[model samples]
Target: MQSTNLKFIFDHSAAAPGHQHDARVFSESLLCQRLEDGWRPLPQGVLLGDSGYAMRDFLQTPIPNPQTPAENRYNAAHKRTRSRIECAIGQLKNSWRCLSKLRVKDPAYAAEIIKAVIVLHNRRMDQNPEDLPAPEEEQEDQCPPEEMGTTEARAAGKQKQNELINFFVR
Candidate 1:
């Protein structure tokens, strides 16, 4: 999901039993693969993701244990920016109670239902955003485990993050 616009760029549904890690699914996604293969250029800005997502040139994840004040500030700013997506998600689930406990018999149908909910949520945000409740404080479980990418990608991601940290610190 795009934080600035609160729009979903892509949505997919897979069997939960096998696809446990979000990074695994995201890494294998066509969009990520295309970007990695240089078939597509990255968008103008960096994307913020939780620890579960590996750091990449286009995606920035938080520093798990920030040692310096600058690093701490960067993590704070990153979290604040990334929280927009979390807010949108909370609103979506709250607006549609059915999403809380999806009792669909088929996984495909469940996917359809989720997509429909997202569409409806977006419409609601567009029409009557004031009515939606504020997003709750993020819970510990929301901070997923970190997943590292390839060595070269990790190095690039670190360099970019360092640049940002320096910018903020300055």
Candidate 2:
């Protein structure tokens, strides 16, 4: 994961193979595990996730069918904010051509290479802050691959999302 400043916050590319589902990989990451264990990374902070991720108290996803202006506004804002990550990824790939096609045969070695590249990417951002790309307009909508399972945690997530919707309209 990356920050709004285009810095790598959590680079768990080694956590799962590239073929794994995005949500599954996220669910298996140590970061998610820590959050599930009631660890708060930041005070009153929430992460914006794409539809592929499950809605959680710490992570917010777009509403599937927005019924009100408030909900629509929330989705629009979410899309805007989430686009930063996408832009960051594009910047990373553009800056480091090697990442475009990894010839590294060993998975472990490739993971190490990715980590090194991410570190270098962050350092480059620090040295040349102006190199960052301007935020782009909303791209294509990311529809959820399947219905996110419903549980008590999901219910809590919905509650958190509603709170955000209210905040937007207010």
Candidate 3:
């Protein structure tokens, strides 16, 4: 599988099931690859994700200064810069009904569905930027979990892993 596509670009894909893992893994791998390629982490920190891409690992790296009252200010700034994919996802989900339904069965074919969704989303975005919602004043964990499928809050780690507990359990 091409890891390039693994990099989440949003679009109509925001609505698919079993997508939380793919989005997170893709974001993680993308960021790690950038780091390996010599991208430096800012001290006050860079908050590098949008909503769907959040996983515990994303938070493991200290965000500049975690204790500051300006909590995640820098990350939020960075987040908006990286939010085009997120806007595309939101718009795609809101605009396309097919995306809301995971009609494909085979895993490989499912990849095609995702690609199609993103491509459509990008095209739409190009045509009408007005439809997309702005990435919020500050990116916070919103949107309740998807029925049984849920997400864990990410805690930044200085080492390799950032472990987070699911809000679903308790």
Best by lDDT: 2
Cα RMSD (Å) per model? 2.8, 2.7, 10.4
lDDT for predicted candidate 2 compared with the true structure: 0.78
The residue pairs that clash in candidate 1, if any, are none
RMSD (Cα, Å) of model 1: 2.8
For each candidate, give its TM-score against the true structure.
Answer: 0.82, 0.87, 0.45
Candidates 1 and 2 compared: the better one by lDDT is 2
Model 1: residues >4 Å from true position, as ranges? 10-21, 39-42, 140-148
Q: Pick the winner on lDDT between candidates 2 and 3.
A: 2
Off by over 4 Å in 2: 132-150
Please provide, for model 1 over 8-126, each residue's C-alpha lDDT reduced to its tens digit, 9 standing for 90 to 100.
55444443433356666667766667656655344556777788887877778899899999999999999888778777777777778898788767767777787887778777768
Local error of candidate 3 at residue 108 (angstroms): 1.2
In model 3, the worst 10-residue window by lDDT is 160-169
Q: Residue 80 of candidate 2: its Cα lDDT?
A: 84
Clashing pairs in 3: 11-88, 11-89, 43-64, 44-64, 45-64, 47-75, 59-156, 60-156, 60-157, 61-157
* Alpha carbon lDDT at 170, candidate 3: 33
Instruction: Write the residue-wise lDDT of candidate 2 on 4-123 in tens digits.
Output: 787886446563655666677777778878777779868588888878788888889888789999999999999888777778877787788898898666878888888988989899
